[model samples]
Structure formats: C-alpha cells, structure tokens
Target chain A: SSFQNIVETSYGKGDKVSPFNVATSYNNFYEFGYGKSDPKDRSSSLKTAPWTISVEGEAERTGVFDLDDIINESVLEERIYRLRCVEAWSMVIPWVGVSLASVLKRFQPTSKAKYVYFETLYDPKQMPGQLGGGLDWPYREGLRIDEAMNPLAFLAVGMYGSILPNQNGAPVRLVLPWKYGFKSIKSIVKIRFVETMPETTWSMLAPSEYGFYANVNPSVDHPRWSQQQERRLPGGVLFPNVIETKMFNGYEEEVASLYAGMDLKRFY
Target chain B: MGQYFPDPGKLLMRLSGIWASVFVVAVMAMTLIGKIESLRFVNRYRRFIGLAAFFYSLLHFIIYLILFAGLSWTWIASDLIEKPYIYVGVLALVIMAILAVTSTKPMMRKLGKRWKPLHRFMYLAAIAILAHLWWQVKDDVSLAVYFSILLTPLLISKIPTLPVYKHFFKKI
Candidate 1:
C-alpha cells in the first residue's frame, strides 16, 4: 500500500540515498534470523496485518491503539536519514514517517516520564529467530524523554513512499537518525513512559560493549572493533568506500545540546 | 552477479572464512574416525582435506588484504593493533602453511620418529582458530559454540594413554 500526503522535507538533502534494494534487503532484524539475508528469506511467515501498539505507564491514554488509527492521526513526511549500524556499515534511507514527539504528545505523558521504552513483537511462532538463544527475546530499546522529543526522532511506518517490507520493520518502527541503528527498535508492540532507565536488549546482553545511549560517536570504539570508519553501502569489491565516522553521525548541531555537560564516553 | 551478490566482497570473505574452518574440522574428524576398521579408507583423503583448508585460509587472507584493506599497508597496520583476532587468525594460517609445505612423502619418510610430533601441531592450529572465532564475536556466540561442540570429542581422543578410547574402540 502507498502512503498519501507524504510531505517532502529537506532533512537529508545533498546526501545520496542508498539503493532501495540494498536498504531493504540488507537488514539487521534479528527477529527473523542472524544472517543479513535471513530476514528477507524467512520473514514471509510473519503476519503484519491488524497490528496494534499498546501504550502504558505515565501516560493519560494507556490502551492498545490500532496501527491504522495512529497513522491516520498524524501527517506523514519523507525524511532521508543516514542509518549507521553498530557493525560499521552505513546506509542512507528515504523513510516516510512523522515525528515521534507528535505521537507521544497525544498519549499525554505525565511530568514523571523521564524515559521512553519500546518493545518489539515477541511471538516465537511469528518470529522464528526468537527460538534461538541469541538475545533476550522481545528486542527492547529506550531513549531519554528529551531525545525522543528531538526533531530527528521518527516513527517510520513506510519507506520509499510505500508500505514497509516485513524484514524492514513492517507496520511500525522507531528511527532515531543520530543513534546507532539498533537503538531504533523494529516492529514495535509496546511503548511505555517510565521514570528510570529501561534495560535495552543489546546493552543487557553485553553491558561492556553496548550502552544505553548508543550515540554515534566516532571517538568511542567498541570493545572489539574501531568505530573510526564505516563502509558505505554499495561498496565495490576492490574499493570498500570506507569513510571516517562523524560525531553524532553528523547531527551534532541538532542533538549535541541534548547531552549538554554530560560526559558522552561515560554514558556510552 | 549483482542480483545474486549485493555485496560480493563481504559474501566472498565470509564464504572463504567459513569454508576454511569447515575443511579444518573435516580433516580432524576424519583422522579420529579413521581409527575404526570400517572407516580406515577415510585416512587416504585426510592430506587432501588439510591442503584444501590451507588454500581456503590463503584465499580468506588475500581477500582481506586486497578487497577489505584495499592493499593499504596503513590500514593493515591499524587492523593489527585494533583487532587482536586478526593476529590469532594469522597464527592459525601460518601453522597450516607450515604443515602443508612439510606434507610430502620424502619429508615424512626422512623424519620418521619426529613426523608424528610435528603434525600434532594441527591441534594447536585448531585451538587458535577457535580463539579467533570466539574473541571477535559481537553478540551471537552460537556459531562458535557449534564449532566448539563439534571439536570437543576429536580433541578428547588426542589425549595419550586415555583408557576410555581403548575401551570404547575394543567394542567397536
């Protein structure tokens, strides 16, 4: 299905968008499988219709809302964002979505809502990879309330001006352009406003390697690999197209104030 | 080719690395299982499989150099410092190369008594490869765990003077 009234924005202007095939096929949705191609191959069994997102905790409206009802309330727009994976690969994606703050505001979050937590669908039958003991099931991610309110924080329901493929987080997913790709949880089933920090999937799996913030900082290297450079998608066989990474994935001017006076390395 | 391999460099690198490990494990399994009378013929192909493992390792290394690092010495040097698993993988490759070069009929006959001890270094190469796999894992350890389980029994059989091997084989 195609989206109507997608207002074009100059969000990622002057950036070359990655090929639609590459962006859709090469994904890190572990709910389907671990291999890069596994999601595309195995996600056919996933049932995405009649999807509903349950809003809970610290919000005035705390009930399950149909995904269509949520989409109808907001105006969709085209925002080209560069998605940088923690594995040191990057892709420029043209995503269709609305600002996350717009959706959260309707829920009427209370003053005590310090953090916004998100959870993915957890059915092992629908998502076969859940049977394997790779990560704690129901992939979870969280962001500070202020970060979620950032203009770059997006809740993408479609991509390339059409409905999302199942492997690329169909129905609904979070897209935070400034943070690493994993922080943008996919196929979300639940969203909650909490007072304290929520335990995210990757950070809980390896606390020393993945942190809650997960801001795209080139200075801080992962425990195993250096984050100084990344291979842009469609890299040739002989030339990898490796380029130096940027602070906050080149969104420092927009997001730097969110981390004012806080030590990024310590938070990372 | 574009339709099949969206990223040829990454696909080839992964294929070469995985095939190298698979052949290494195959050679070890054949050596252990060939001890049985019914499977004695499997020993005849052990040398070929070991050489195949070495060639795959060489391919994996070449791809890493030409395709990944783009033949840049600076990038290679940086990788040596930043990624310790690269050195461990190199260690395994170097051991396999030495074993392959020495795997000749004349060399085997000349060093009759010492040949068995030198060839036993395959075990060391296997351990290094295992470390290389485990040390670089980002989140999932399932592949490393699977390889470790596959190698555990073959490693146990290498223990000299173990009565369990003798007792178990007598019944077979």
Candidate 2:
C-alpha cells in the first residue's frame, strides 16, 4: 500500500517513497550488528521509552529535554525525502519531523559554534556490536553548522505516518538528504555545537577512504567502489534498476551554493 | 537458507570470502607448520582445504548470480562493464575452478614435478580472491585487510632472496 499524508516538498515532489519494509529491514546499523538484516532482528533489544536527548556546547541554552516533549513541542509532518547511502543504495522516505534548523534555533547556538555533532546511544547490553570494540561506540557524525541548518536537514520523529521502528532509529534520527546515509546518524542521543570540525565514525575508521564532509558526489568515487551509480532500494535487486547517482543526490540546485568556492574532491 | 540465515547474500559473501582465505592459510601452514615440531601432521589436510575453498567460491558466484544478477546471463554480461569488481571476481573464480579440478592425486601423479608448479597457482588464486573482496568494500575492510596481512608473510617468504635484504628475509 502507498503512504498517505505526505508533506510534499519541492525536493521530493514526484519521487515514490521506498516501501516501509525495505526502509526498515535493509539497514546498516552496526550498533545492532553488521549484517543488513541484523538490525531488524536484533534491534528489539533497544528500549525506546523515556528517551532523552542532550543539546549542549557553544549554545546559549544547554539542557536535557524529554524526547516526548521535543515531539509535542514541534510540528510533525510527513516529508518525503531521498536518502542515498554511501554503499551506493538509495531510498525515498516519508519522514515525519520538523527541520533541524528549527530544532537548533530553539537551542540557540552562539557564534563560536562552527560544527554540529551527533551521537548515538551506546550500551553493549542492548547494542551487542559495542562488545566487539570494532568501532568506537556511541557512533558519531557531524557537519558544518550551515549544513546542519540547511532546510533539507531534518530531525525525524516518525515515518509512514507512525512512530519510528526500533531498527530505523526509533525515538529520533538525523536526515541529511544531500549527504550520504552514514552522516544521518541513527538513534541519536546527543547533539553538540562545537568550534572545530568533529571527526565522524566512518572517517575516523578509515580516513584514507571516508572523508569528513561526505556529501554525495558521484565524481569522488570511494577507493573501493564507484559512487556513480546506486541500486534504488525496495525491489531494486529484482528489477536490477541501477541508476546514475546525481551530484548531492540530485539536490545540487538547492545545495550547490553551500560549497560554491570549496573544492569538493579535497573536502571529500 | 534455514530459518536462521537472516540475509543470504551477505552471509554467502562472508562465508565464501573466508573460504578463499582459509585455502591460502592452509597452504602456507602446510609449509610453515612443518618447521614447528608436533604440528607436522596438519600438512596432510592442505589439499582438502584448497578444494573446500574452491567449492565455497563457486557457491558464492552462484548466489551472486541468483540474488544480485537475477541469474540472467545478459545481466552478468553487462555487469562485467558496470561493476569493475566483476572482472577480478570472474577471473578468480575461473582460476579457482582450474585448481580444484587439478587437485586429484591421479592428476598429480601423472604430472610429477610439473604438478607442484601448476598447483602454485593457489597463491595467484588467493591474491585474486582478496582483490575481489577488497575492491567491493565500501568503508570497513578490516576483514579483507586481515586476510591480506595473513598472506603477507607467506608472500614475502616466496620472494627470491636478495643479497642486501638477506638479513631480514633470512627468517622468512
């Protein structure tokens, strides 16, 4: 069945949202486990009730807010957006949330804030992968302050007109349409405003392959695989519909100016 | 897949890749373990490991054909151009097949001294297997990197001795 009450935007007007099953089932939440289906099976251990998010650092107002209050305080609309994974898979999602800019404005970041960092929940008991120490737990990701404020940047509360599933970052998650999926950190617990660039989990794991500013640029192919194409999710495998990846995931007109003078390859 | 295999493609790739690594590790152990006392008995199993690795590799290819390519020869043909990793993977699979077919004792006895040189293709097969895996990884490659690291000492040991580097290469 198709989704209802889609908060249509110029960014995702004609796009067909990927089936909710694919969006939730095919995930790369390493915190749950490594396999694509691991999260779907393992994330049941994640308890989402009574969740709290911390907003701190270089901000005028620094405090802890109840997750329910954050949802009740803001407008929640179903906004469909394209999500391109760095692994060359793509999905269209009807996410319910307000712009990240609006959320940040409530926190009131001071001029010293140059970057915005996000962290995921860390607990080996719930998130078994944390026991491996393969990655620095509390998976981290960040972006330039401006990028976090971009209208395309979203803090999601729900999808498919329902509360988020545990596998899809239940309570809340970040959604940056123009950047790779990893940049949109899942199961977010902390959002911080910092003076310097913050190192992301993937970039820290392999600096030579993954860059900090992981904007979707087809030209800057990952050393391992081509970024030029992606298999659109939700039956993409059966259809074998591999499409050419667009610059900034086809949001170039809206986001191109953000990096106008900077060399993407170097920053990438 | 039984009810437990959550994702077949992922598990197949991982299992198949490990088998390739296992084959090489066993080959190296066949020689390296001989030096360590009390471990000499393990050399007898090296051939079985090689055959098992090739079979696992074949299973990997079959799964990719069905899951990723939909078992279409035409799709496989076009993928050869689209995914560069396919070129390396197909070459490795073909080499693996050749090694497996030639592993029988009858063939080995027929070729005599020439059989050892022919079976040395195992090393090339291992490199190809690693390259196939290494080329496809998106970010995390610690497993593939670990396989390469394990192969490194064996690779260096095989290199011809140089007069200058004999000091370090002597142990290898």
Candidate 3:
C-alpha cells in the first residue's frame, strides 16, 4: 500500500539514493536469513496486517496499540538518510515516517524512563531464520532517552513513497541514521521505556566487536575489520565506489553533542 | 548463480574459497581412504584434485585482489597490517602455487625422493587455510567448525604411531 500524505523533506537531497531494487534486495534482516538476498527471497511469508505493538515499562498509557492507530496520529514525512552498516557498506534511503519522539511522547513516559528498548517480532513460522541459532531470537535494540528524542531518530513506516517491503522491515522500523544500520531494528513488536540501559542484541552477542553506542566513527575499527572506509552500494567489481567514512556517518554536526564530555573511544 | 547474487564479486569470492577448502580437504581424505582395495583407484586422481584446489585458491586470491581491494597496492598493504588473516590466506595461496608448479611429470621425476618431503608441505598449507577460515570470522563460527570437523581426522591420520591409524590401515 502506498502512503497518502508523505511530505518530502530536504534530508538527503544532494546525496545519490541507492537503486530501489538494490536497496530492497540487499538487506541484513537476519530474521529472514543471513545471506544478503535471503530476506528478499524468504520474507514473503511474513504477515504484516493487523500488527500491534506492545508498549511497556515506565509509560503512563502503556498497552497494546494497533499499528494503524499510531501511524494515523502522526504526519508522515519523507526523510532521505544515509544508512551505514557496521560491515562497511552504505546506502542512501528515503524513509517516510514521523519522529520517534512524537510517537513515544503520546505514551507519556515517566521521569524514570531513561532508555527506550525495541524488539523485532519472533515467530518462527513467519520468520524462518529464527529457527537457526544465528542470534538470540527477538532481535532487540535500544537508545538512551536523549538519543531517542533526537530529531535524527525516526520511526519509519514506509520508504520510497510506499509502505515498506516485507524484507525491508514492513509496517514499522526504526531509522537511526547516525548509528550503524543494525541499530535501526526492523519489524518491531515491543517498545519499553525503562530506567536502566537496555541490552542490545549485537552488543550482547559480541561486546568487543559491537558496542552499544554504534555511532559510525571511522576512528573506531571493529576488532576484525576497518571502519575507516565504506563501499557505497551499486558498486561494481572494477569500480568499487570506496569512499572515506565520515565521523558519525556525516551526522556529527547534529549528533556530536549527544556524546559530549563522554569518552567516545571508551563508549565505542 | 551469478544472476541471483546482488554482489557477484562477493558471491564468487565465497564460492571459490569454499571450493578450494573442499578440494584441499578431499585430497587429505583420499590419502587415508585410498588404503582400501576398492578405493585404492582414487589415489590416481589425487593430483587432479590437488590442482583443482590450487585453481580455486588462485581464483579466490584474484577476486580478493581485484574486486575486494580494487587492485590498490596501498589498500592491500594497509590490510596486511590491519587484518592478520590475510597473511595466513596469502601463505596458503603461495604454498598451493608452488605445489601446482611442481605437479608436472618432469618435475616429479627430477625431484624423486625429495618430492615426497616437499609435497608434505600441503599439510602446512591446509593448516594455514584453516587459520585463515577461523581468524576472519565476525560472528558465526559454524563454517570454520564444520571444516575443522572434516579436517581433524585426516590430520590425526598423519601420525604413524597412533594406534587408531594402525588399526584402520591394518585391514588394507
């Protein structure tokens, strides 16, 4: 289904958006599978209709809320953003959604709500890759309250002027452009506003390799690979389109202050 | 297969790497299994399989150099410093190339007694390839674990004094 009132914004205007076919086909939605094309091939079985998100912990209006109700309340806008994967690949995507802060504020998060946690749906029948032990099921991610409230943090429902493809986290997903792509968890089913720092899936799996603050800093290399550069997608074998990676994925001006005074190297 | 893949370079790299490892492991398996009368004929094809392993490894190396590193010597130089697994992978490739070059009938005849000791370096190449597999893994170790399970028995068979090896070969 296509979106009705998608107000286009000047987020990634000058940047080249990756080919829609390439962007949709190449994905890392591990719930569908590990191979880059697995999600595109295997996610057709996922049922996105009648989806509901369970809002829990430290929020006043906490309960199961229908996805349509949440989307109807917000004014959807197209925000073109650059998505940098921890694996050193990047894509420019035009995502349609409202600010995450707009959605969370409706819940009236209490003073105790210092962090916001998100989880992907966990149905082995629909998401076959969950059958494999690649990760702990129900892939979870989180952000600090301040980060969640950041203008850059978006709760995306659609992309490319339409509802999201099932492989691309159909129905709902987070789009934290400044952080690594994995932090933008897909097919979210739960949102919890908690006081303590929430445990994120990748960080829990390999703490040394993936930090909680997965801000795209070129200076901080993954234990196994360099983060100094990235290959922009639509890249060919001979012409790889390798470019120097920017600090905070070129969003340092917007998000750098969020980590002010804190040791980014240590936090990373 | 190329049509299905979004990044053919990455697909080709993985395919060549996997096939190289498969053939290398098969050569080691053939050495022990060839002891049986019914399977002894398999020993004659060992050189062909060994060559196939070298061919695949060469393809894997070329893909890494051209597609992955974009033929940039500076990038490769920096990669050698940052990623230690590349060192082991290069070592394995170099060993395979030497073995491939010496596999001809004339080289085999000239080397005579020295050939057996020199060819034993294939085992060292196998070790290096295993190290290359395990070291670069980001999260999943399943592929490395599977290859290890396939290789461990063949490696142990090389120990002449082991009672298990003696028992297995006694019937043949």
Candidate 4:
C-alpha cells in the first residue's frame, strides 16, 4: 500500500524509481503464503502468548523459560541499523531489544559450549510453511559462541518502540545485524548451546548456496548475484538504488573482530 | 547459385525454421533445471541460451519504448540519437525481432533466400545483448558467469559443423 503512491507519483520516464527496493521490503515468506502482502495478513493469526522456550543442550540451567521470565527487567533500546538481505536489498530499521548476551548469561554457557543454536516456534498448524518440505521446517539457525556473545547480537523483542508485530517475530527473536536475515531466527522457542554447528534451515536445504556465517559482506558475492551494490528501501523516486554496500553494513568496527582471521568468501 | 539447385536456398530457410523451433523447445525444458542443478550439469539445458537472449532483447526494447521513451515517438527518435548502448541494444533487438517474427514455415517460405542470412544475425545479437548486460552490472560477477554460459555456446554454435553441434543437437 505504501508503494502504490510512490509508484504512481514518482515513477514515469526518467522518474528514477527502482523495482528492486519494492521486491525487498514487500517479501512474502511463502512459508506464510503467496504475494508480498500475505505475510502481513496471515501472520496475525499466529499465537505468541503462553509461549515457552525450551533451553537445553550445553547450558548449566536446562529447563523451559516462560516468555515473561525471558523479558523481565529487560530494557528495550532502539538501535537504528542497516538490514541487508542476501537477495540484494536493504532497509534502515529501528529495532527494539536487549542484548543476546544478557539473555544467555541468565542460563550460563557451560565450558563444552562452542555454538548457540536457536529454533523457531515449529507448529505446522501455525507456520503453514512447516506443512511442506521446502526447508527441514521449524526454521533452525545458529551462531559461533564468540559471535553470539557480541554486543551487536540482540535477543530482539520489539521494533519501532512497540511490541513486535507477529509477522516481524513477536515475543522474541534473534537480531544479528551483521549477518544475513535468516541467521536472525524469528519467533524463537528453543535455545541450545551446542558443541558443533547447528543444521540451519536454508543451509540444510541447499548447503552449497548458504553457509553458517552468512554475513552481509560486499566483497564476497552470493553464488547467484553480486552483494557489492544494494537498493535502499522507500527512497524517493529520483533516488532509490544506493551505490556500494558497506563492510559489516557499516557495523564492521563493532563486529569485525568476531571473524578476525576467517575467510568471508568461504564462510559466506 | 540460383540456377544450380533451382530453390536449394528455400531448403536452407526451412532448415533454419526447424533449428529455431528446436532451440525454443530446448530453452523451455531448461527452465526446470534449478540454479544449483545448473552448476552441477554443464550440459544441463542449452536451450535457455536463446530464450534469455530473447528476454534481454525484449527488455531492452521495453525500456527504450515504455521506460525511457514513454512510447513517445519524438522521445524515441532523440533516445536512439543520443544513447550508444540503447542504439546497440535496439540493433540487437531488431535482429532477434526479425528471427522471432519469421520463425514459421510460411514466413520462412516467403522470405526464402534471405532467411539464412537474416537468422545468422541472431548469433551477433546474442553476443551484443550479453555484452550489454555484462557492462551494465557494476561488480556483480554472478551476472557475468550467467551471461557467459548463455553466450559462449551460442557464439561457438555459429561454427556450423563443429563437434559442439553434437551437444547442441541433443536438445534440453
């Protein structure tokens, strides 16, 4: 709906509108339904209350954490950051959340912990995509122990200062700003501290296409397209595609040390 | 040459039409091969070679007419005058447009002697369009590999009776 006015008024000969940005912000996580608008409509039916996160694996305190216990005394801070997708588009969003380290510290990682694995709430009844075999379903993702400990990594609870919309991962989710969007699993219900890499949904679906460290690096391109440039969302017609993507999406100074000596091309 | 076979040239035109049909079907079948699968099989689906070349040329014309010129006759004349890439793209589009328009038995029969030479222009158009796409992308090497796969064989296929034709004859 927001795009209609932009398209009608700002798009014409030499008007400078880009179709790329429209495709980015208006994504249909077909796991939800079809059309760019389906996620917004069908996602509301998702029940987030009475949620329980099963915290198991290598954590010292292994038990279910109710949604209330997860967010108690949690101060939500609005952090404005650039979200670049693997699909070549980006958005500047103000996310509201407390650090993931704060949440993880509550349980305490055991010495055996080498990675943090998260599982999306897997109700085949609620998440329609779970009904099919596009992914292993339940949408799984993980991060290296050190990467999970970074300050930029947040266990996001809200966005735009209000509680998160269902479509935007209500109740709780991961927000690793430096990595690809998938790494930030939404509607998370399970957190595991594992000794090895977790089988991520997209990576499991196509191991060669996606890797564990799916960071937003301009220098290393996806096998299908270049990540060097990106289309900035909701720009005026005359200016849409912004030239050059920044390293770590301009968060390199904050997150570069996390991957100090690794090869981004192979890791990506 | 005309007196030698008294319409041997018509045979070549009909042959080109058959070749074009075979090319169309092959490209259609190739679409089923997913991106990852395309990487695994070098001979995955060569038919999409001409199909993508067809779309790029179609997009080139649409951009000039709908996006750039706004279908304004006055604007098109000025655009064809000023933009070098647009002019080259239009030339490629014109050649593919002719091949597309005349890719039939009756049209092939009517065009006769001119068909073979006219259709040969498709090879050049494919190269030109690929070059046009390659030059437009800033740093995305993925697009380069994509166009390279489609163009390299189309360019090589121009060598009429080479062993590559053995691979080409086996459609998608």
Candidate 5:
C-alpha cells in the first residue's frame, strides 16, 4: 500500500502477465505447506507487522532494523520480471523494491565478507513446514558478494502494486530474477555476511537435486526430468500452456557474465 | 466445491492422475502378491478400483473443460497436441474406458475365453500411465519416479516361469 510509483516496466514483455488469482494462489512456499496452493490458503495466519531483520556478521554497520526503517531508507522501484520456477513453470510479476546492492552498501560489509546468507523465520507455529523434517529448518539462501551487489539482484517488499502478500513473502524477500524462484527466500528475518559459502536449504536437503547458484540452466536436467521446457501457468487448469525453457530465465544477456568462467553443469 | 477446493480443476487433475496410477498399481497387485491367501481379497474389488480410477480420470477432464477451460475447443486442441503427456493420458483412459464398459457380467460371459486376454489391456494402460507421469512434469519428477518404483515389482511378477524353475521363480 505504501509503494511509490517509479515506472519500471517493459522488462518481461513477451509473455502476458499471469492472471492475479493464479499468481497469488499458485506458489512454492513450503513453509506454508507442501502443496502449491497451500500458501494462499494458510498464510493468512502469518503475523507480519513490526518485523525485524537481524543483520550480523562481517559488516561495520551490523545491527537489527525494523522492516519499516529498511523500507524508508531505500527508494521503491517497480520491475516486472519473468519468474521461472525450477519446476519449469513461469509467471510475470511486477515487484516493488530497491536493489540489494543499495541496502547492503548501507550495512558496510568488511573485507572478509565474501558471501551474503539470508535466513527466514523459523517458528513452527507460524510456518508449518518448520515442523516437517523434509528440509533443515529456518530456510536459508546465499549469494556471492559480487552476485549480491549485482543491480539485477533485488529485495522485493511488495508486488502487483500492493504490499507483499504473506504467501508471497511479506515484509521483505530476495528477488533474484535470473535464478529459480526458490532462491528468493520468503519471510526473511536474518542476513549474515560470511567469508565462506553457506549451504542453502534446498542444496542441503537434496544436494544432487538443488545447487547453490540455482541459475536457471535448461541444459542441466533434474535427475528425474528434463529442464528443456516449462509450463506457463494459469492456462486452462487442465494442462498449463508450454514453452521452451530459456537460459537464465531469459536474462542471459544481463546476468550471464557473472558466471563467465564457471561450469554451470558441475555447479548445478 | 469452489469454496473448499479453491482450484477444483487443478486439484482434480492432480488427484485423478494420481488415482489412475494408484489403480494401475491395484490392477497389478494380485499378480505381485502371488500365492498369498490372506491377500486374495484384492481380486474382488480390482475391477471397481480400476473403474473408479477411470471415472475420476474422466471427471478430471470434464471438470477442467467446464470450469477452467470454459469448454474452449481451441485450448483443448492445443494442449492435447502440444503436451505429449496428455496424449499418453488419453490413450491410458481409452484402455480403461474400454475395459470398464466390457466389465459387466453379461459382457464377460459373452466374451468367455477371450475376456481374460481382453483385460490384459490393463497392463498397457499401466505402462501408459507411467509414461504419462514421466512426461507430465516440466522437471523434478520424484513423484512419478516414486510411482514407477511401486510399479516395477508388479510388472516383473508377470514374467512367465520356466517349467524347471516354476516353483522357485513364479513370483519373480
């Protein structure tokens, strides 16, 4: 509701914006529940006001900040991004937020800081997935310091011209356009600057299946299925419409240079 | 249904597809558990379970067309043509439909000796379901692979035992 109008569109123009009902209702926030639609159904119970982000580790200005303080500090810009899921589905979302680079700069990371690790809230009472043993709890994600500073990397606080939906990651969340959607951890509460790579939740749960980078690489297939195609969601509900998978989720031109020398297949 | 289901068409599609695979497993369960007297009761309901799966599969389609697709013929045509998994699912449903229609007591009596062979089409539907599951997801097919693991033993149990090794290898 407090979102500013900063005019950032014409990014993901090829695909029509996925309808609102489908975009909100269809999601992969396992913390809410296992099913795709569970987040929308169950997340109304989430307590979101007066949230705090505990910023610690390898930063000169390390301290906790209220969600409002962070919002006030950064200028909100609306960017419509094509969100491609690791499951080979996609949607266009108009996200409102500032770049992670601007926010991280205020924290002033030390020379020792090589990576940025994010942590989601861990209460089982609030997030049902914390009760399950499927993943190590308090869902975590990380990025190389350089990747974190990339202008393409974003910290989304809201979407669709409204305050963030609880199911969509209320208060604040990372929104990495080029990576699989899950890399953008939801309901983030802790941010740690680290010298070494932190094992992300998905990567730790199934190392062979999920990788740390998680850049959308169509060539590197998931063990049981091919990643060469994706279903554009909210079609007829019988079968989602299909499309060819794009490298870096159609942002290869913008962010491919970040991985110029590394092998995606091995890292994947 | 709308209030509770939220997305009835999507939910039914997923559930019906899963039921089809489950019943395919049921259709093969007796073959998998050979000579086990306690489990002999499974045969009595095998036809009904298979028919239920077919009914769900058919309802899955009809509900989707009515509620979600608004009976848009063009979208249905595109999905049937573009999604290879849908083609396989249709084939599997066809097998189930034929078997269900002929499952009546009078029809079984009419076919007589040929009925047993005709019902072997269930195996074809089973394999088709597996293929359909494999093709259904864009990636991360752990569920499909899980179903496949359950199916492997049942299919293997159908192998014909040799005369010399009949007793030792019947359930292999």
Candidate 6:
C-alpha cells in the first residue's frame, strides 16, 4: 500500500492521534550484555515509578521534579513527526507530550540561559549499557535556546498511543523533529540550563563525525557516508532502501526560520 | 582444474564451500579480537581488513542469479537480489573462503598436487573484489582507499608475476 493508504488504514482520516511508525531500528550496541535485541528484552528492568529529574544551573526554580508530578503537571498532545538518524535512516513517529518550551517555562531559566543540557539515567545497576564503559556512562545531549523553545520540540511521554518502551526512551524524552535523531535524548534524568554550550555525547567522542547541532540536512554528508539519501525504515523488497532526504527532514515550515543567517555547512 | 573436479558445476560448488570456510575463520577472528580488549586487540583489526571483499563477492553471486536466471521469478527470487556493489563482491569472498579452508592440514593433504594452483585464485579474487568495491563507491573514497592500502602488500608479494605483466604491457 502507498504511504497515505497505510496511514489512513491504520488511523481513521479524522482521528487526531495515530500510531508510531513501528520498525525495529535496532540499537545493537551489545556491550550492555542485554543481547542484540536488549531494547525489547532487558529494558523491562527499568523502574519508572519513582523517577526524578534534577533541574539545575541557570533555572530560577532549581529543584527536583518528581516523576508523577511531572506527568500530572504537564499537558500531553499527539505530534506526528519524522526522525532522521545520522546513519542515514529515517522513521516517522507519533509522539505524545507537550512542547519542550512549556516544560522549560515551569523551571523558569534565567536570561543568561542560552542552552539546555539533558542527561540520561546514570544508574549502571539498572541500565546495563552503562555497566561496561563503551561510552562515558550517562549519555548527555544539549539543544540551543531557540531549538528548545520551538513548538515542534516535545518532551515525549508516550508512543503508538501508549506509554513509551524503555528502549525508545520511556517516562520522558526530548523529541526535536527538525534536528537529527540524537538531539532527542532518551531516558532523561537531568535538565541543566547553561550559558555556554554543553558537550553532547557523540560529539565528545568524535567531534568531526558528530556536530553540536546535529541537524538533518541533505547537503551535509557524514565522513563515512552521504547524507543525501536515506533508507525509510521497513522498506519492501521491491521498493529498495534509498530515498531522497529533505532539508530539516521536510520540517522546513516549523524550523527553517531558526537557522536563517547561520551557515549549515560550517555548523553542520 | 576441470580435470580433477570433472564436472564444472561441482567444481563451482566446492569452490564456494572453500570460500565459506575462509569467511567463517575471519569472522571468528574478529569476534575474538572484539572480546580480548587488550592493546594487541587494537592491532588485530588488520586480521579482517578485507571483509568488504567477502561481502562484495557474496553479493555479486547473488545478483548474477537474480539478473540472469531469476529474471522471470521476480516475486520469489527478487528477495535474493542485493545492492550493486554487494552483488559484485562474491569473487573476493570465494577466493578468501578457499584460501582459509585449504590453510588446514587435512585440506592441504587432500589437494597436495593442486594446492599451489588453487591458491593462485586469490590473486584474481583480490583484483575482482577491489574493482567491485571501487565501482560501488559514490562520493566517499576513504573506504575504498582503506581497502586498497590493506591489499597492497598482498599484491606486491607476487613479484615474480611482474615479468608476465611486463611482457603483456609491451604488447599493449
């Protein structure tokens, strides 16, 4: 069936909410020992009931937001968005949550706050990936002030009209539709508002490979592969695994204005 | 070569098996290197530097079937087809596979008289594999360059063949 046909068949034409584009975009970084399909298997070990986020740095109300309180306090809405990975693969996901701007508003960052840094849950006892140090333990990501404030930017609570799977960033995770997939930090535990740019996880590891912004632009090619083409997830045998990538992943209406004067070639 | 095998078809199948065994050994070595996590393990990357050659040969053989024999069987056979470079890559894999399998004592004992001639297939396989990789590269030449650097010593070691090439070059 065509893309429109698939969407209409799954969700009624008038339905405001739709299912997340379901595909096992495998994260097989097996250093975690949870196995190749650990995201589906071992993520059950995560305890999401008593969660808390440390809101620190330039925010005026710097304190902890209880997991339950955070969920109850915010408004949740469904936003159909495209997720483009740096590896040249793409997926359309229907996320449930309110704007990131609203979440930041409650914390009330000071005027000096130019960037927002997010830290994932660091407990190695629970997140097995952290147990063995392939990365620096707790994965960190940051967003520019304008990028965070964009209405399209969301603090996702649910996927596929249900609660998020632990592997897909359960409880709450940021989803920046315009930027590359890494900008959407998963299993968030800390939110820090900072004056200077915070070091992002992939960028710190290989600065040349991963940029600070990490936006999805067709013109900007990765060191190893071209970003000009993408393989839409769950492609059929007849369809082939290549598609023309669009600037901002076709979210030009909402995000093009943010990077008006800056050069994407240099910033990319 | 055809005299020992008798049937050309059987020879191809036997050749394919040899290639598979070589691939298995290389994969095992890579797995061991990944687990060792020592300073020597970092140096062990060279153990499987030419993996793309194997993958390319596997792809090449698969595509030949799809494009030629399986052209009419699109629905069932189309699933077997692969990307272009991947299709052209099987020659490398088959060569590597033979080299790996014959590296064993029992296989060497079985093909005592023909072992040397069989090993010569590696040269053809290496060149075909490089060509396959070179054709598939779109914009990034780094990956091709990496493979080229890895194969350089392997190619250069056959210095005696230079005279045959020099004779061919004079004719050209």
Q: Write the per-residue lDDT of candidate 4 for residues A50-81, one digit (tens) a residue.
A: 88999999988989989878875335566655
> Which DockQ-derived CAPRI band holds candidate 2?
incorrect
lDDT of 6 by residue, B1-172 (tens): 2112112222243245335334433443443356565735643553343353354445445443342122334322322243334334555566766676675668879999888677666666656656665765432355456656666555665544565676765666
Candidate 6 at A176: error in angstroms?
Answer: 1.1
DockQ of every candidate: 0.38, 0.17, 0.35, 0.04, 0.12, 0.05
B1-172: candidate 5 lDDT, tens digit per residue = 2223334556666776677677678667865553578877776777787688788778766765665444556545655666677778889889889999999899999999989878877777878888888875533467788888988777655545433557767556
Which regions in candidate 6 have their CA more than 4 angstroms from the true location? A1-21, A24-36, A237-241, B1-56, B60-172
Task: Report clashes for each candidate as comma-separated counts.
Answer: 0, 0, 0, 2, 0, 12
Error of 5 at B125 (Å): 9.1
lDDT of 1 by residue, B42-152 (tens): 999999999999999999999887766556565576667878788889999999998998898898998898888788889889988889889988767877888898877
Clashing pairs in 1: none
TM-scores of chain A across the candidates, in order, are 0.98, 0.94, 0.98, 0.87, 0.95, 0.87
Structure candidate 4, residue pairs in collision: B27-B47, B27-B48
Docking class of 6: incorrect
lDDT of each residue in A1-268, candidate 1, tens digit only:
8877889998898888888888878889988888888899999888889999999999899999999878763489999999999988888999998899989999999999999999999999999999988899889999999999998899999999998899999889999988999999999999999999999999999998899999999888886656777777767746666777899999999999999999999999
In candidate 2, how many Å is residue A220 off?
0.7
Docking class of 4: incorrect
Across A112-223, the per-residue lDDT of candidate 2 in tens digits comes to 9999999999888888878876677779999899988888888887888887888998779998899999888888899899999998999998897788989999988775
Clashing pairs in 3: none
Q: For model 4, how does the per-residue alpha-carbon lDDT over B50-83 read when each residue is reduced to its tens digit? A: 5544655465455434432234454345446654
Candidate 4: residue A186 Cα off by (Å): 0.7
Query: What's the TM-score of every candidate structure?
Result: 0.90, 0.77, 0.92, 0.63, 0.74, 0.64
Name the candidate, 4 or 5, with the larger TM-score value.
Answer: 5
What's the candidate order when arranged by decreasing DockQ? 1, 3, 2, 5, 6, 4
Question: What are the clashing pairs of model 2?
Answer: none
Query: Each model's interface RMSD (Å)?
Result: 2.6, 6.4, 3.5, 22.2, 7.6, 17.1
**Residue range B79-147, candidate 3, lDDT tens digits:** 778777888999998999999999999999999988977887888898898899999776568779989
